[model samples]
Target chain A: MTAGPPSLTQDEVSSSPTRCRILATAERFFREIGYQKTTVADIAKTLGMSPANVYRFFDSKKSINEAVVERLIGEVETLISRVADRPGLSASERMREIILALHRDSIERITAHPRIHEMVEAGMTESWEVCSHHVERITAVLARVIAEGKAAGEFRVADPAHAAGCIQTAILRYCHPVLIVRCPGDVAPPIDGMIDFLLGGLRAG
Target chain B: MTAGPPSLTQDEVSSSPTRCRILATAERFFREIGYQKTTVADIAKTLGMSPANVYRFFDSKKSINEAVVERLIGEVETLISRVADRPGLSASERMREIILALHRDSIERITAHPRIHEMVEAGMTESWEVCSHHVERITAVLARVIAEGKAAGEFRVADPAHAAGCIQTAILRYCHPVLIVRCPGDVAPPIDGMIDFLLGGLRAG
Candidate 1:
């Protein structure tokens, strides 16, 4: 990788250590004090930097929140991608693992860092494009597995992409942050049962 | 046809015209001014009644909201039950109609009386029991249809209740008030496609 000059472009600045530090500090503040209560100044102070310096990285708190959420969800996306690319796993097994990974990650995050939910809520409400793109990426991965399953003669779906969308939507109750928090004592079927049901759909003639 | 005396029990009072009027007026206020802003006194004033009378009917605004939500979902439960009981309709057809009705009703309510969503949100937040019971009732109706379908050799599910719960949870993205509003430009599969996919689950061996 080429070392850029001090006067870096926007993309180069994004990849710099300073940007990563700002995001990490902002995420810590969001987890500790909640997103709505945390300010850019607080993040900067925690990092021993000036507010103007932070502003140079992120124009506003909302942009900072977007970056923070992106960083958090990036971990999940990486985990899911790893599961999808695992060797010797059937499509059904991969689907199960991926769905379980998503659910487990959501539960762990919400349980371990309840305050971080505010940041996620803000991202969903204020930065919907980020959430939408995240969804599209997840759906694309699911579609790949579905297409593989169809080609393997394990699934009878005519359109892998459409079926993948349906599966993702169906599993939202188990994986969505808001739903998991809101319906703590949910009356829905367990995740395994739900997966089995959806797998039945995939394997149907 | 058994009319009670002037001193009515809680059950009898709930069926009284005055109580009905109070609920109706409260619903109107909730629709017009939103749940957080609509007070018992506002509802009482609109109905030419005392706040004490409204209190006699409903102990608090939260109670009134529970009742209002109960009444609203009562309509949906009835509609689903009717579909479940319709003559000569196959299980798949009934499921499709019920899901479509739920989606239609959600869209209509959110579109026509956007403020009414506040009351629903309040019910979900403050009176979760009412929401839980509504879910149970809907799930029960779906279970009954699934049972009938299984008996008729239309569906291949082993446990109707479990499958019903799964379907109900799966369709939440299409029917839930908060989700419909929050995901207005949702990228999920269309309702028809979702219904077909779910039917595949039910019909799969």
Candidate 2:
């Protein structure tokens, strides 16, 4: 038997029209009604089909969510790849760009469908495996950048791995109020201070 | 109305024997079986009482968990107060010690109680009100320390509130692996190095 062609782009792979429509509808439905409250009937109704037709597409509500989460994971994977592909940039510059990109993208995307993000936070316990592997993969990309930075003498960290960990921690800590914990009234300081502090730490001074 | 009497020390306050027993059982059961798996009956059985007898003291599983979390918060409050009472240390020393203490205690008392901590993470949405208040109170405690340190000339930071916020972010970032994601059999990086990096960031230099 001949092996299938392996030249499919991700868009080609996930873009089977039926899967696309189902995912689009389900993501919207899940965002509006929430994961707990959304039903197969609602998804099917939104798609102008019977509830059983929705089942034919997904084994269960959980499976549809798994697909949605997998879709999210794929987007983050692309982010990791693009940063890894930037070979000409210094490690510090690359790392800075990646961190800023994640920050800006999270804020922008989180605004469009806040509940979708909340759904991920909600399912985190139950779906930790799905989410954390993607996070670890993201971390690994930064680790590569850190190692390259250290080798080039552009950064002066004793442990590339540990420094990478610290960078991720600092970014998340700064963003938690904005994204996760819902801090009140924009009461926090600007992110530039954190960026400066991190830059200073990374430098040999 | 007359102001209420000030409470005595934890040691001096006589906790009712039944309440203590219930709390002890709750913590132990939560640790062994986890929050969702552990039932009122399981706790009652451990205490050699009928499940019905347990409800006479607490209305539901939620109330018992609330008591456990309340006790944790109370311990944290007590720790901050004790630090406030210590008069001789320079304000910088006090602030550093506070940061270190929070890092230490959270890892020891809270992280050590795996199931309770797991429940707290899993039920963050369910208990957002309680968790937010707890975080804000802790934030205030750290903010006050920074304010005192700046006033006493032990800290030269231009912004106490921002410094305090950064301190909280640093500690939370330090504890991220323990709190947000489960780290798998990986040896922890030296907290000493991490703390030095943080202090460097916060330093007047």
Candidate 3:
């Protein structure tokens, strides 16, 4: 039912694949070693660039790390934009889709690459501004869909903000796939039930 | 009424005033300066110990960091164990207590000292094994409580494994408190509701 790691889209930045390659290589190196251990020279050498050239792209190791994180998270942000831009999708449905996409990606992308994700989380260390900025943007996107759904009389909720919070937490619960659901004889809880609860909670009563 | 941070119990290594002072001072330093920046020598110098003498207690900088994290997590683990071991608390109730404790601490301690907590998470970055170990232990503790509750007919669940997974996810959701809950003018959804959802889908019947 599931396909192996889907081939990454490679044509997005045809003009600047080198920078993207550097980021990709850096992500792998960071996961294989770690953020603290991975150096700019290592990343450049892996990308076939001199450390001096890498410095031209990123002034320091922190900058390169930041760029890689920004790149991955940028993908997530694009998903938010896509969901936000979808016309004719009900707010409830929009919220559901966003939740499913996030849960699916965190499980597929993040959990599958826990070491890299941990490295990223580490680099983000203490930068609430990073987490806050990302969460707020995503939350605002959800809020928009919820408000639209409420106006359309398709949903019933006294507070879209609260609903958004509830949805975000529920979706994020899927981040640790191993702890949440082990395969083979471990009955994974039905995430569908969660979607049902959110929809039902927001339904016109 | 919520009280201030609980004093360390006799079981905690920091139960004594001297160790508490060390932890307190260490926490402040880690909070004020980055962990890597705040060296053992710096901590010792602040504590009025010679750099060499600081080694008398801690074997390494890593060891000192470990001790500090161990002390902090030790408190939360104690509360979780106590709830899990309660004579009559249902699985959901035990989970509620644990989540509330986690949420309270994350908001109070981790959030207030975001940089320190980030370092804490990052230091554990070398190995998901650290967080994974704790998650597994917590899940096992929750597993026992769920099994016992099901056996006692106080809780109805098709699978303790799945329920434990849900519980694990639900509790850790509090790890990012500020992101999950809005602070002003809007009351977030009750966390008790999340406990119920994890315990048994929307409707127990």
- Pitting candidate 2 against candidate 3, the one with the higher TM-score is 2
Write down the TM-score for model 1: 0.92
- What is the TM-score ranking, best to worst? 1, 2, 3
Worst lDDT window (10 residues) for model 3 chain B? B178-187
Provide interface RMSD per model, one decimal.
Answer: 1.3, 4.3, 7.0
Worst 10 residues of 2 chain B by lDDT: B180-189
Which whole-number lDDT from 0 to 100 does residue B7 have in model 1? 50
- The TM-score of chain B in candidate 1 is 0.92
What is the lDDT, from 0 to 100, of the residue B94 in candidate 3?
Answer: 72
For candidate 1, list the clashing residue pairs, or say none.
none
Error (Å) of candidate 2 at residue B104 is 5.0
Q: What is the TM-score of chain A in candidate 2?
A: 0.78
- Per-residue C-alpha lDDT of model 2 across residues A32-57, encoded as one tens digit per residue: 76777888888888788776655556
True contacts kept of 2: 0.21
Q: What share of the true interface contacts does each candidate keep?
A: 0.71, 0.21, 0.18
Clash pairs (backbone) in predicted model 3: none
Name the top TM-score candidate: 1
